[model samples]
Target chain A: MRQSRLVQASLFVFLAAMLTGCGSHVPLEDLTISLILGVDLDEKNNLVISESSPVFNQDAKQNIESYQLKAETVRDSRKYFDALATGEVTAAKIQVLLIGKRVLEHEDWFPVLDTVYRNPTFSLNTRVVVVDGPVSDVMFYVPPDKPQMPLHLKEVIDKNIDRTRAVISTLQVLHRQMYESGMTPSLSVIKKEKDVEFTGVVLLDKKGKYVDTIDAQNSAFLLILRDEKKQELTLTIPMTSLGEGGGIFHKNQISFDVSRVKTDVKTSYNKGKFDFKYQIAMTVNVAERLFPAGRVNQKELEKMIEKELKNRLEDMVKKFQANKIDPIGLGIHARAYQYEQYKKVKPHWDEAFAESNIDVSVDVRIKSMGAVN
Target chain B: MKMAKPTLTLPQYIFLIHGVQMGVGVLTLPRETAEAAGTDGWIGIVLSWVLATAASLIIIQVMKNYPKGTILDLLRHYFGKWIGIAGTILFSLYFGIMATVIFIREALFIQAWILPRTEVYILIALLSIPSYLIVRKNITILGRYSVLVFFMTVWMMIFFIIPLKQAQWLHLLPLLKEGWQPILDSVGTALFSFGGFEIAFFLYPFLQKKEKASMGIVIANTLTLFIYLIITIGAFVFFSPDEITIYNEPSIVMLKILEFRFIERLEIVFFAFYLFVISVTVLPLMYMTVYCTSQLAGEENHRRHLIWLLIIAFVYVVLVPPTFDQNKLLQRLIEQAGMVLAFAFPLCIWAYLLILRNIKRRGN
Candidate 1:
């Protein structure tokens, strides 16, 4: 019995040792936590990094926040942050990366982005945004009313890009677009206007350098062309009557409130010529009817709207050709359909894209008007 | 004291076979097959299963004819004592290599995913102690424990299948675009995935219902094949063929993408689930190794001798490759050893048995 007790004691001790060795933890005080970071380029063409986190009081309520630090590089920023913050700054918990306009415009942002991608702690799924003004200004924007302002910013950006009618791009998408052949990426562009600001999208070239800004209207068109998830976008079309008694022609703007939009792109190549067709099917709510009110001729109005939409869509396709930006990934379609042709013309795809013949067709089916007529 | 008699049913045998056959190498099977066959890896797996079934049948038939004898006893009966001892040593060495390879692979996975800072020696010690304790149990107890763990492992696969909605079915399309050469190459690599079916030779004598052993082997191979198909198709669909080739552990990486409302990293949950499966697999291999060792040594107190043998084996495994790359080289050597034991040895035994039967008929 005594020997059995000794054996049990030894087993218990062994178990304790094993458990202790396996279980390793980091204390909260020892961790350098970074909530958000904003990156931009200074006048010297060096990287400017700014990081921020909320300050908590003894009772666990957030108090006055700390000042943002500007460093020459991300590594220096971490060193500066480690001295200021209580613990070492861990990149694993970084929620968002905000890039300033100057940084986006800089010729070499790949090195900075590559560092983030290579870090084990930093996730490729983290949200990336381009700030129009100084990144520090955007970082320090804390509305007095909202305590969780950073989370609020994330929610607003995510809702605008994902659920609402705005273009959305993540780090993974950006990396794939920049690295993979036959594709270019676009990021949501944020412009700060003292109190009220507009957020749209900026297109990035294959090398990940900022190319040009897409206006809100063009951004909407680009979003539609890309077939990204969107809700309630307004499309204005100039109407022309094909037959007599077609809308009286005075109120020329036919407004379409797009409820549902689906687009299919087909590519066919024949004898060194690429034929591209974009088929758009959409459900629209007729916001206005300017024709005589006696009997609202549904077929005439539908024809007018369809004709106007086809014209506008053709113009949009022409604009995409002029800019040589295939937001719809037409090049991807071409490569998939005609591999041999694509290979022969692969080097001059951009020049070929500018000269490619793209045909646009719209088939709109009006589901219902509002409660009116 | 004599151990309690085991009442082995077909389902228990099926569970044991499934548990043993599915191990660390399976996670890399698709990529390995793809490397060998290009796009026809799935075909290789199907053909390998066919070969495995035939091999399993030969083993069952041989053991069923001698219901009270194991492979060791049968070897002694057919070949002389010296040859029997050598054959037993070869099998023990094969099992030892397999156990060592599995331990290293599990260590690398744990280090890469779960605990990057943890020492490799500590991980080996932790896994080996529990496995040694489990291996000390009788075969009946081991079988029963395997059944319990088998169900637990199956349920964990539900987490792996959650990413199926995002999978591209087109990646698996354009079938046979590369022709039959790749398919044959894939079959050679995938034959290793079906390695543990030969455990039937060791397990057949312990079964209470001897006739059911063949059915049990078929059922186990079928279940393992089904699981392999699900994970292979799932990985292929979720990742492009190029991406699948790049990932070291595609199944684990696929699991990493899945996020629940509560849990952020489902890979951790999978790692925990796989821990149970690994233990279940390691116990049988360790038991078989010790059993073969005792038989070769001609020891009466086999159980006591088994404890020391396991310790020595564990120490030997821990001392081999110091880094993950070197460990992979060791694993390749072990797989080559597995090919000889699993395929070549069984084919030789079956041919010998058939020739002996023919000679007896002529003499009669």
Candidate 2:
């Protein structure tokens, strides 16, 4: 009985010591987890930090606020925020990263991203975007009705990419493209307009430096060329059968309408050259037929549509070459097909790509006419 | 010395074999196989199963000739005392190294996933206690518990197929594009995953009915092959090939991606299941090590001797560093040694026995 009592006393003492050690490590109760982080470079080249979190009101409506801080470096920015804010500064809980245009152009973005990537708490799946103008201006521009706007940015980017070809880029995808050969990373760019609106996308080189932007029409072509998605497109072709230099049949005359398009890409290598054969099969609903307006034969209609698509596609490929970008990943396909040749020519691939020959083939099969027909 | 004890049934024997066969090696089998064979790694596992089945049958046939004696005793009978002592030492050393490898790997896995702050020595000590106690039990109870845990581990595998929806079928495309050399290399790596069949050579003496035990080994091999096939194919089909190459523990990573409404991380459940399987594997090996060592040392009370061996294993495991990379190196050495002792040595014994039998028949 005495031994049993002694054993129980010792066990209690050990438990007490453990509890005291744990008590010292206890964290504060009112800690807030930051969900989105934005960074920019100010005029003095100092790093500026902005964070967004969801806010709840007494009526249970959701609001959001963007916290701002400026310091000499990313680590110092966190220290500055900690001194001013109420909770701990943790990068692990951040789900979205936004960079200002000036910061992206002047400073090395990789060092800032490397800190996030190496942190164990941070997830690799966080969505990253670039904002135009100073990040502080965009961060401070909060809407009157809704405060939780960062979450909306993620949804808007995801939905737009899914619905059309605006292209939403995640951190993992960006890292892979930047690291791999013959590929460059691209991110959706947003700039605040009057009434809290955003526009445009900025392309970056392999090193994450700003390159160029494509407007709406060429952006649509870029989406189609990449085979992201195709909803409705307008094509113009001259009608050849009306008569020589006649109305609607004249050469260089425009006959265009909105139609559905589908494209397929195939790659092959022979001897010392590479070939990309594009087979574009499309079906057009006759919305407006200005030439031979009675009823056109399906064969003649298919041939004319095929010709028009081929010309436009060839022009688009030329534009991509002129811009020196391969969003279609033709270089990746080439390396995957002929890895040995790629290794030998990898250093000079940029020059080779600029000089490489491209072939385009379009086959348009018009399955159904529009309701007007 | 001639005492009667409870004996295990055929189903119980099969369960013990299956549980022992599927140990730490199965966790990394798919990644190792894929690294060698690319997309056709499943074929290498199938080929290994066929080869392991043939080798296991030969072992069973040899054991049937002397129903009351183990391989150690048979070696003593056929080749005399000195050679048998040497053979027994080699076998015991192999078991000891395998135990060390498994224990270190278990400690590293637990530290990384389950208890990050826990000391490696404390974890090793705690894990070794249950195995030491369970191994001291009679063989019949050990066999029964192995069956219980084997079924529990199989039930745990049902959660693995959840990631099938995310698999990229294009990664498996251009099949057989790399040719036959990679498949052969994969078969070499897969042979190590089929290591536990050699337990039959030592176990034949304890079986109640020797003839039935041979058939039990076949059933056990079939079941193990099926389980390995499911795990290997499931991992390949669920993860992209690039992802599989980076992860050492593919199954645990697969489980980490799964989240239920009630459960946050299913990998914790898997880690617990792995602990159970490791205990199940270690107990039988400790028992065999003690049994084989005492017989070779000419000791009377084998149970008393087992206590000392357990202490030695405890000290060794505690002193070793709990790192995944070091454990991988040790595992490679154990595998190379096992290939020679378990597979190649058995073929030699069978050939020698055949020669001896022919000489006696001719004299008669």
**lDDT (tens digit, per residue) of candidate 1 on B217-304:** 9888888888788888787666555446755667776675566567665677678779788776777877788888877777634466
- Docking outcome class, model 2: incorrect
The clash count of every prediction, one per candidate, is: 2, 2
DockQ for candidate 1, please give it. Answer: 0.26
Minimal lDDT window, size 10, model 1 chain A: A238-247
Each candidate structure's TM-score, on Cα atoms with residue i matched to residue i, is 0.85, 0.73
For model 2, residues A196-246, the per-residue Cα lDDT tens digits are 443545666656677676644455556666655534454455555434555
Maximum-TM-score candidate: 1
